[model samples]
Target: MNHAATTDMADAPVLDEDPFSDENIANPYPLFERMREMGPAVFVAPHGYYAVTRHAEAGIVASDHTRFTVEGGVGMSDIRKPGAWRTRSPISEIDPPEHTRVRAALQKILSPLVVKTWKDKFAQRAEEIAEQAVARGRIDGVADITEAFVLEVFPAVLGIDVPPERIKLTGELNFNQLGPNNERVARTLRRAAPIMDWYQQVLQRDHMRPGGFAEKIYEAEDAGDFDAGTAPLHVRSFFRAGVDTTIAGIGSTLKLLSEHPEQLALVKANPTLLKSAFEEALRMESPAQVMFRTTTGEVELGGVRLRADTKVGYHMGAANRDPRQWEDPDRYDVTRQTAGVHRAFGVGAHVCIGQMISRLEAESILGALIRRVQRIEPAGEARWRPVNTLRTLDVLPLTLVAG
Candidate 1:
């Protein structure tokens, strides 16, 4: 726990750990514990980046972009370098002033008023989905509930005409591509190969429906609120950033609620705790496990100095479970006041803009299910979908006992 800053930057601990390894990607908490025990910031030798494990240091990495700049790209690889990614997200990949302007434009488009109006729509769909799930009783929580609800409501709100299967495939491809280009990425590329063209074309202005959120983004672009030709990219960002992660979080929520009947009972007794239950699920298994930033200069994190221009990944999955910040961090306690405290939605200005939408979605679906189901019990073992930098459930079997 003693992470005394060394004057010699090279004195930082070097771990040969490959976090993207299939084993670690499947279940990372053990390695995360080891990494946290090592130091707040340790150089990951294999990937040649520093891993920030503790909560405080991770916060610094996420918020103080002055020290850990986003200019090098948010992913582990610096996109500005040769033969890397060609396009940066109009939102995530940029810094202040220009970022400020784009954010304002986006905020105006996705204003509280605009988002609030979708509540009834989300609730109506949520009720139908929940009723169907309860009627079936036995169900794959992933397909029957989580993916089904999110795939239906999220895209409808976004106003894109993507098939559910294609969205799921492309989501797998995107999350895998975020980290190392390992077998997982290769496998996903093969799976998504046929639909790559469809993925690209589906986000275009021509594809946006009149009343959907994507259409409004295009309208904003037309009104000089965004750069020409960036409307599609913004919509693309919304799709990529919003859908899969929410599905992952919601799936985890359902899985956890089923496994922890006590917590479910608490939620059932006090309906308000349903929100906390979802928050706890997100804390336990964050969808986006790690987010990267490049050090602008010699940056000191928890007294460990990081090399300039090197990538530093703030392991949200690890930080959320840090013993220093969270007491008995591994236990899934529904009463835990985790909403603002946990790093699940992220820290600082660049935090998930769609978090309210995510919250709305979770609350709507979970609320409906809670109202109808007396007990949510596991039907079989749950299997995690192993993307390099995402923790999500691929298969969650559940028995929805109706009230």
Candidate 2:
């Protein structure tokens, strides 16, 4: 790797050319296209990091944690560094062997039997929310449906008493921390400033409701399922990963279905397709857009070589929509056999542990809505919230005529 050769790849097209730029964040697909066209691994000068764009390459990078460790921190900018707002999530911020132990403990706690028990609870809440929204004939899809379902169910499951109003502030801080310390990060940090100390209190065992997952984590810790003091961190990981992602995926689905009535009709006709519909939306507009790893040594992805100890950012949003991997990549179709094929939950050892919980939540709520609504009509424009690594809707108004 001579200076000239190093400079060539380093000078390649930046994937997120303007990370804090609203126009690019609002619609990142064009930039995604540019990165996919440039090379598998591109040196994004804007963020001063290399990003892996294609589907195969993204999967390879995500799975090869040995070559690409998570210990440097999973965000685009390392959170372990000074001035980072978030404390590291123990489950996601460590390499396997250690990660494997923590994850296995969580899996046992969040087992299928445990998740299955929540289905009835989610179903009841789904019916209540959907019926209320349908009665009104018009509703803000983001708040009325997506946020309503997640805010109700997710917190209850986690045992945390997080106020609904504080969610956006905390979420903004989390998403902004995933990228560079740009204006977005500064803005969100200020908003979340008042609650920073309280956020820590909420994650503690004393605040968790009895019989909730957070308490169960503490129980597990008592039983030696995990090391002492790691339980609260595990709970925080679930809270951070679970809530916003489900909201983003469901919100994106509603936004797309509103835009494409034909697609909406397809899901209405077959409620079972709700699963595939959500999966498709996740593939199309992933909630968490980018994830990163630190290279253990000089490694090769596609044909490009990365230096040891460097950060390798994997763009899941770009990978899922890669034309080479998906037919008519940009089109939103519920009929596509997207389940198990997409990397939205990640792949290999670090795949999302709470993925089943997310699917169950989506199926319960989206299924209830599909069954009750006759048609999903757009009432007004939908707007996306501009967070550095999350693609989510800020508002989605809709007219839901009852069946």
Candidate 3:
């Protein structure tokens, strides 16, 4: 390496912490605070990658594709390297102007009109489930509410059939694989092995429900909007990208509401605050904790010079809670206006296109439940499901006290 580059790398702060370790995964904010305190971007020695913890640096990395490209893949290990993830996401793993074309085509299929059509369906189902939960009085919010709702709705809209078990396994596997190839990845892969064929088959054209997005993708490809044989991958991307994260976000919102009755009251008193309640929950506990970007060349991030072609993780979970960007960052306040600012939905060209859909899903269910129940209270402790890149609740025990 050249002298200037070598000195820059050496000058960067090195943190010998594993963000993906079991303890950290369970409760990452503690380590995130330390990393954020260290610098804007800290070099993670064990993984040989830079960790972008602060809000500003994370935003820059997420938006500036020229400096930090997606061509090298948006995972910790470079997809260009041998033994890394073999397949790439047609939507998220490419850079413009090709990315622009792909995204436009996909957007055409999921136009606002098409998405708006799902609202009534989403609301109807959400109300039914919310009413059921209220009648029961106590529930596992994760299974009874969030998972139950998303697993049914998201796939129906995307035009795919997937068992909840496979969805969970694949969600775990995909997120874990995005980070270091640790035991978590291995365990999920093994459990998912039997369903691998089903997973692949479910996204095919024949499996698509008529008039759904998946079928529309195939039609778009036929009309020459996309390359032949790429439609299935798009459907796969849509399902994976849309489902679990929405479930996680909704699950977190419910758990948060149960924990803070006053916040629940805020939403219930002013139904207009319902949208912000979901946004605040996402800001407080982002679902997809981090996303990776590759350093296209020697770049200065948060004053730290990073090596070329290396993975840099932008921890949105950290950035969302970054004290510099937020007041009382640790507290859960439903009134917090964090939408569009929080890294939970990301930023720039690659910002989550499914964000509006996620928001709608969250609001539909949350609004229904909030209206139906007198109060949401903790029936038992909440549990987090650990995956390398995804932050989601596993179990949320709650009591829906009826008014």
lDDT by residue (tens digit), candidate 2, 213-332: 889999999998787788888887888889999999999988888788888898877877888899999999999999988877766667676776777888899999998899999999
| lDDT score, candidate 1 | 0.88
Looking at model 2, how many pairs of residues clash? 1
Clashes in predicted model 3:
0
lDDT, model 2, position 361: 91
**lDDT for each residue of candidate 1 in 1-403, tens digit (9 for 90 to 100):** 1124435545469999798887888889899999999998888999898999889888888988788888787788898988784378899888786788999899988888999999999999999999999999999999988888899898998998888999988888888877876788789999988988888899888898889999999999989999999998999889999999999999999988888899999999999998899999999999989888998876677766777789999999999999999999999999999998889888887898998899899999999999998999999899998888788998998999999
Q: Which ten-residue region of model 2 has the weakest summed lDDT? A: 1-10
Q: Between which residue pairs do clashes occur in model 1?
A: none
Give the TM-score (vs. native) of candidate 1: 0.97
- Best of the candidates, lDDT: 1
The candidates, ranked best first by lDDT, are 1, 3, 2
Clashing pairs in 2: 14-44
- Give a tens-digit lDDT track for model 3, residues 127-236: 99999989999899999999889999998888777788888888888888888888998898888889888888887888888878889999999999987788887887
